[model samples]
Target: MVHDQYMSLSLVNINITSYCMQFIDSLCYILVILGLVGNILGLLIFSSSRHTSKISSVYVYLATSSSIINIFCVIRYALVLHSKTRIIINNLIGHVWFACKLYELSFCFRLISSWIILFWMFERVTCVSKRLRTLFYRWNASQLKFIIPCIIIFIILGCVIGPPAYMYQPRISKNKLSNSTIKSMNYFCGLPSTVSIKWQKYFNELHLGLNHYTIRCFFSELFPAGTIIIFNSYIMYYLFRTSYQFSQINENKITKERQRTTSWMNIVLILHSCLFLSSLFSHVVGHFLSVEAHETWWVLLTVLGNCSLNFYVYCLSGKAFRKQIIHIIQRLIILISYKLQTCKQQQQNHQYDNFKIENLIYQSNHVENINQPKSYGTKNYPKTIGINSSSPISEQETSV
Candidate 1:
């Protein structure tokens, strides 16, 4: 009886795990599709002709970085799905050098995406702060063009520290079967081999606790999160202060514009702060708990949220962004409607041409029947033969 109960419990656990895995996989797939769509729409909206001013450059950078991060999320989720399948594809991707490098680069992109938002907030803070306005007064179109290269360089420099801290390699383990021993391999992205050895040695020798994961997490995740929060808070404070100043002054178009911009930035800052905090919490929890099943879902949800939140914020907050999005949607609808109409017209023309051809063929066949000579049996032979000696029989018969 106890054995049966144990078996039943085991089966129930298996079913639950399967259900959870399926749900997580479905969620990840949906999030990946949404992230791609949202980020692409953001890129299109930000890169438009109307948003070419230096003021919009921060948004342009944010959009570009977010798109790249979305791509990385897609890849990461795909790998997770592959890994869950426990197939050869996962082995190839996980153990291969180039694949490992790509994975590392994804981390770099994630960091870059986070820091880019911080930079954007910094720009906002500077724009709002009276003391900092003069420092950035020279910022122009030419200066804005260099932001992309600077971001690239920043990401590269940040990623340079990753290789020594972590490495990807296949781990081998032995399992004892009923009759024999079996060896299996799994890939891990963790501490470098040397670091792992040193970590053990240091703990054994000096009883000290310092390791690679802690270092990587601190630099890549916590530091960026802290910086973003700090800058975002400053931006908010300065924006409020600036708004108060604007209210005290006499009304002018430029001052009104500045107030509007500050308001927009405040809305964006609030949304980003919420997104960043949620993502950071999930990331930190996943790292510490190491609960693969639940942690994966949490991490993916946070990533999807982070990737898509900005687009929604822009649409909700920025009048220009909303207008551009609507314009793009309208144009797309018009383009699709035009193509559909063209196809329908072409189909109708094709049908009409077919009908005309059919009619022509029918007429040609009727004419052929009329022109053909008709022969009758002996009863009608006299009529058939009496038609005409010189004229065609068919024409004579028709005349008769």
Candidate 2:
């Protein structure tokens, strides 16, 4: 009876794990598609004439970069997380150098994108703060220089840490007793174990303590989360202040409309930061704690979810983004209707041409029958009956 209980418990655990894996797979697949389409549309909209007139050119550049990098982030999720894609990618980039470089690229894109977004939030905050308005205006003209240098710095940081974090190459281990080989590349480029025990211990200590715990948890995860909280707090405070001012100045329609637009823009920024923080918190917790396989999967899903949510959040909160979306839809509908009309006209013309050809064919056949000699009781009649019939009349007239 005890053994039976254990067996049942094991089966239940297996079933739960299976369900969790399926759920993760489905969610990743959905987010990847959504991210790709959303980012592409975002790129187009940011470059649109309407948006360029309303938003600062500097902000547009930042937004364009964010959308572009977010695309890479989604791709990294597909290559690293999704099972089928991971297998194909692994087979293609199974070598140590390629795998490490891929990881490094993922790290760089993710880190750079996040920092770009953070700076963007700061830029928004400056616009909302009355005292900083002048500063914001000045920065607008020269912000590209600042942004470029920061990106270069972040790229250097990522390059330093990303490649070294995963030092070991993948291996295929065989169990002679079981006569089987383990073919899973899940641990590809993970920690090294074939070295000496002393070196392995050192490697584990350095990798887990410095790279995983200190640098990743504190800098990559916590620092960004902290900044997001700070930035969002300032934004929310400004919004409340604006509402209060609007209440006091009841007759200022311009101020009220400005407030509404500011709120709309910041709301998108706040929501994006909130989602990012949630994913960061989850990642940090998962790093320090012992989590089940399903729990780890859930954490990973949240990370990708944050990457995928930006375009949607903007659509929901930014009036400009929605307007751009509507415009795009309208243009597509017009184009499609135009294409359909052309196709119908072409088909009609083809049918008319066929009809005309058929009529000509029928007329030729009728004329051919009239001209052909007729057989009447073994006698062949002359061709061109009309001419022959007319010849007798003309000859009678001449004889007269």
State the lDDT of candidate 2 residue by residue for 302-351, as single tens digits: 76777788778867866667888888879989999999999999999999
Clashes of each: 0, 0
Clash pairs, candidate 1, are none
Q: lDDT of model 1 at residue 317?
A: 58
How does each model score on TM-score? Answer: 0.71, 0.72
Winning candidate number (lDDT): 2
TM-score, cand. 2 vs. native: 0.72
Give the alpha-carbon lDDT of every model: 0.59, 0.63
Clashing pairs in 2: none
lDDT of 2 at 11: 14
The local lDDT score (0 to 100) that residue 371 gets in candidate 1 is: 100
Worst 10 residues of 2 by lDDT: 1-10
